[model samples]
Target: MKPAPFDYHSPRTPEEAVGLLAELGEDAKAIAGGQSLVPMLALRLAVFEHLVDLGRVSGLRGIERRGDAVWVGASTTQTAILRSPDLAAAVPLLTRATPLIGHFQIRNRGTVGGSLAHADPAAEYPAVALALDARLEALSPRGARTLPAAGFFTGMWTTGLAEDEILTGVSFPVRGERSGHAVEEFARRGGDFAIAGAAVAVDLDGAGLIRRCGIALFGVGATPLRASAAEASVLGVKAADVDAAELGATALAEPASVPSDLHASGDYRRHIGAIMVTRAWRRALREALDA
Candidate 1:
């Protein structure tokens, strides 16, 4: 199927894009890379009267370090982020998860902002963004306001974005001396959507004990979830002493209730989610110790 007829606008600047969005209101769609939105358009799942393409936008497509955080422009491609020396050095978990998103072709065309706006629970970036405690910068007719990662996702395929808002960029803290990141997932095929996945980041004390740990799960709930129970299990424990098996069990002990899809049963998702969590946690712990 082809997309429904729509007016298209290529905005060279964010100000122009914001103005277009304000003019077009809810009928307008902001597209970058179009990896996600194009598919929606082709399927007619999204019916927009106006398509505001941001590929030409000058300020929304780069990576830079500001103060203590690494700021990624919303339009930055997954491929670009995966290869970024600054991102890898500052937030390796994003690098770890980027390759898991899809094939190289998809990564080359998928924008970080696009993925976040799409808000697919199974996508790799959202969980990493949440685990890293990233801040989303969005522009609107009302002016710009930052949204915390925790408050970004409202539900499946949904976000807090107002009709006239466009995500400008995201900012996240750089990894510290004893910090590490990890991601693990399983799929029927290499490039397929994950049945379940986990991204973990751990900060250790000089004594190698977990000072802080964040475990985020994907494809096991309506939206990607932070595994507070699993994180709590590892806190105060030395990395070497962490019982991964127990941690896995703990994550699945009262697994989140999720709707069963034909691709995988609810129980299977819970099981796989637990395994992914454990793997990510273990790898993060090792990385933290090595730091």
Candidate 2:
């Protein structure tokens, strides 16, 4: 089905974009890349009176390192991220997750900011952002504000962004010398949305004891979930001594709520989520020890 009739706007700058949103009110929406919004519009799942396209907004399309954190512009495409060697070095988990974000063509058009703002509970980027404790920046008529990843996602397909706010960029914190990251997911077929997935990051001390760790799971809950309970289970323990199976179970042992849909049952999702966590934990452990 075709989308309903709407006004199309291509803003030259962010100030112009947000101003349009503020003036147009809730009926207006800011669109970037069109990967998520376009499909929804076509399906009649969403409707907007106006679309303020950011395609012509030059200010929203660059990747740069800001001291310790890697800053990625809101319009930065997924393919651009895959091609960035600097991003891979600074935050390998994001690089690893980018490949699993649908097909190459989708990645070519999909933007990181679009995915985060869309906040699909099953998407790869949100889990990665949560795992890395990435900071998201949103712009509004009020001013710019920074939000921690933990607080940004409020529910499935919902975030902390206000009606007139635009997600400008995100900054992923850089890990120390002995840190390592991994992303593991389970999909019925290649390029399919994950039934369950885990993004894991670990930091090991000199003697191989766990210094710190972060685990974020997707496709099992309303929002990308941080497996803090499981992370707390292994603190200061020898990396090799932590059982992947037990840790995985601990990760999904208690979710706020596991989604149950035609794709999979909640119990099945939890089971698959545990297995993904185990695989990711084992892989991250290897990388951390090898580092």
Task: TM-score for candidate 2, please give it.
Answer: 0.98
Ten residues in a row with the worst lDDT in model 1? 250-259
Candidate 2 displacement at residue 64 in angstroms: 1.0
Highest TM-score against the true fold, candidate: 2
lDDT of 1 by residue, 1-291 (tens): 999999999989888899999998888888888988898899998899999998889889889999999999999999999999988999898888998887999999999999998999989889998898899999987888999998798899899998778899999889999998899999999989899988889999988888898888888887888877778877898888988878877876555496589999988998888888788878887887888
Q: Which stretches of candidate 2 lie over 4 Å from their true place?
A: none
Model 2: residue 65 alpha-carbon error in angstroms:
1.4
Worst 10 residues of 2 by lDDT: 54-63
How well does each candidate superpose onto the true structure, as a TM-score? 0.96, 0.98
Each candidate structure's count of clashing pairs: 0, 0
Model 2 lDDT tens row, 196-242: 99999999999999999999999998899999999999999999899
